[model samples]
Target: MLLAAALLAAAALLARGLARIEGELARAAAAGNRPARVEFVVPEGSSARRGVPPRLAELGGGRALLGTPEGELVVLRRDPTSGELELERVYRLERDPERHLRREGAPLHGWFLTDVERERRTALREAWERYQSALAQALEDFGASLPTAEEAAAEVARRGGADRLLALTGPEASALQRRTAAIGLARAGYAGALPALLVLLRDHQRNAGFFARLCALTEELSGLALDPARPAEALAEAEAWLRAHPVRDPYARKGAASAGPVSPPR
Candidate 1:
């Protein structure tokens, strides 16, 4: 009777252990199936759905000041391993010179900056600076030098110069690289590169040439010279104008004539 009781108790303990193991396994499976919260950053002046910037991975730690199509400024932070970007904060960029200068100097990530948060923001700022430096180095290393006005024009005249620069506006290019490409495209007279430039400006407001080069390109591409002195107003006005006057294909209407039915031999 004692032996029989011992066997029954052992079986109960074993069943409990098995049940716990199964539960753990089920939880692990569920976690593995959950998708990573990765988001693609869209370019500034384009549709939110069009293109994903290549610089997304490099903009990790949510240090980037990203802009949505609606013109809202957002700070995004990402998990290093999971590559998931979570919204850390949002700020409405003020256009007024005094307000803009004041707000630009204030803490962007939070209402109040603790020592730890301050350190983090500083680190992020350093990272951005480093990335920008690296981008300039990369472009030079790639031999697409755009040092002066004359050099830029000559570079664009070279075979694949415009194409190579245009390619930099793709997902792989950094904000600085994209901005450089925008200038090159404008100099190349490639109007198609306008949207990419606009998107770059929208997505990265902190990037250099945000107002100067971008505004110039906008005017050249769209033929609507905006007031560059007021960057905020100019950006918004140019966006509105571009929306109203979309670049139609030079041959879209022409295709209709070719598609019509031909008469049979009579």
Candidate 2:
């Protein structure tokens, strides 16, 4: 009886929180939204460089993204006929940024960073810096022992060794090497790799790229991206997924065709 009462209280609180969110959304929908004017930052030595820039339609008609006052990314559509840019078709109440890109390999061109997203990215950058710093310290301690980032990535893609890839992600390897291995595991789409990826995800050294790549692999492999915000829940869900899809190949049937196309966390 006590447990049931607690669950009911929790449900009521959730409903109230949701109601407040819905009210805010309704109020915001009634107001005008503005786009931010800022330059895009292409990460130094980053793999995904095809981000759509704002006013790309000025060069030619292309689908891009726009940041609005509402702190969300809205798809900017260009009319192929008139070469005019506008918001995507019929996006009134429903405005989930991920919905903007329906195609599997579509490039998310323009960056629309909200204050919240900026804060999040700043934190992520710091985490990456810390991770890289730790990696450099480890590298100084152990000189040139394991394979290079390019070599490790290539090896994992060429030969289906999930264990080898997992090892490369450990503390002994450089950040570049570790990122490449994680990207390889995701792009290779190996069923055996999925379990290892989940373990790595749970290991959770604030691996920002891993989360996005996990979305890519989960979607590509099972046609699903069931994200649980919390890491523990996400691991549980992945375990459930493994149980559901038992008969998958150990490696990519068609090698790493895509150069590790990553998507936003869903």
Candidate lDDT (C-alpha), each:
0.47, 0.47
* Pairs in steric clash, model 1: 43-199, 44-199, 45-198, 45-199, 54-171, 62-76, 62-77
Tell me how many clashing residue pairs each candidate has: 7, 3
Where in model 2 is the C-alpha error above 4 Å? 1-152, 159-182, 205-209, 228-230, 252-266
| Residues 1-266 of candidate 2: C-alpha lDDT, one tens digit per residue | 22235446666764653343333333333343222233333333322244443121111124444433333455555466774445562221233457437767543653333344445556545544543454464367552422243333444454435556667666687555565566556566544445545655665525555564554555555445556455566667777877866634554333343535432222
For model 2, name the residue pairs that clash: 51-109, 52-109, 52-110
Off by over 4 Å in 1: 1-154, 157-161, 203-210, 248-266
User: What C-alpha lDDT, on a 0 to 100 scale, does residue 202 get in candidate 1?
Assistant: 68
RMSD to native, candidate 2: 18.8
